[model samples]
Target: MEYKWIDNFIDGLIDVYGTKDIYELYDSLEISIRKLPKCNILLQGNEAFYNRNFLNKEVVFIRDDLNMEYEKFILCHELGHAIIHTNIITSAFSRNLLNLNKLEKQANYFALKLMDLNMDEIAFEGFTIEQIANSFNLPVKCLKLLLDSKNQNI
Candidate 1:
């Protein structure tokens, strides 16, 4: 379950694209982004999804109701599937399971690394993980996953 490769992949992408800005990365990679209303049942209560159409064009559909910060994280998560999962179509729905599957963890890790939040540095400055998550408008669970991954040296 080690995911250092995800970090490496993101690093290579940053090196090639010259930016960690998710929107900029999507633009440079020719990925289309669409915003959908919360009433859209197509998502099945998910926040977002990623897929390649019959024409093989990559696209991400996000819920327009999310706040700016959460929206960015959702976009980054879907972009993870676009880059990491590649051929696999994926969604960002809530899973009731305690343990996340590999793909979900990988996508979450990708979102964390892509954001380049410097969590360790921030933690060094005396901020609790919850506080950090709140300041960044990220879910505490997601931030905890990132911290756990780092703790494991992954």
Candidate 2:
């Protein structure tokens, strides 16, 4: 799907926030982020989630078990939902498939854009998907999502 709107929205965020750091972006948006403690549910494969708390405050919860890089990507993904799908609660689980739905794809694209990675530039430099994924410390499937969406006219 063409997501030029999402691209523009992310660019607007970067222009306004002056940074692409997920933590800083969340802070600037007044969204609270929490780290979930290790538990049975977390062990059952929940990676992260975003929701409006009882106070109607936006909040993102990421599992503590993830590596720093993965955690950052997860945060960015949830932030996507918070900004792009404000009325919807979203979650990321290890078991979830990529490209599962329009919403998921939007969040994935948002995460990629928010990271400020120039896919065309990277590809022009002769980097393979695995190499890019390894270099960025991101999951292979996440990079695959980016690759799949690359030719979709933004």
- Using Cα atoms with residue i matched to residue i, what is each candidate's TM-score against the true structure? 0.82, 0.77
What is candidate 1's local distance difference test score? 0.82
**lDDT of all the models against the reference?**
0.82, 0.78
How does model 2 score by TM-score? 0.77
What's model 1's lDDT at 94? 36
Model 1: pairs clashing at backbone N, Cα or C within 3 Å: none
Instruction: Give the residue spans of candidate 1 off by over 4 A.
Output: 54-56, 89-100, 120-129
Count of clashes, each model: 0, 0
Residue-wise lDDT of candidate 1 within 18-81, one digit each (tens)?
Answer: 9988899999999988889977875667888876772688788889899998998999998887
131 Cα displacement, candidate 2 (Å): 4.9
Report how far off residue 150 is in candidate 2 (Å).
2.6
Error of 1 at 99 (Å): 10
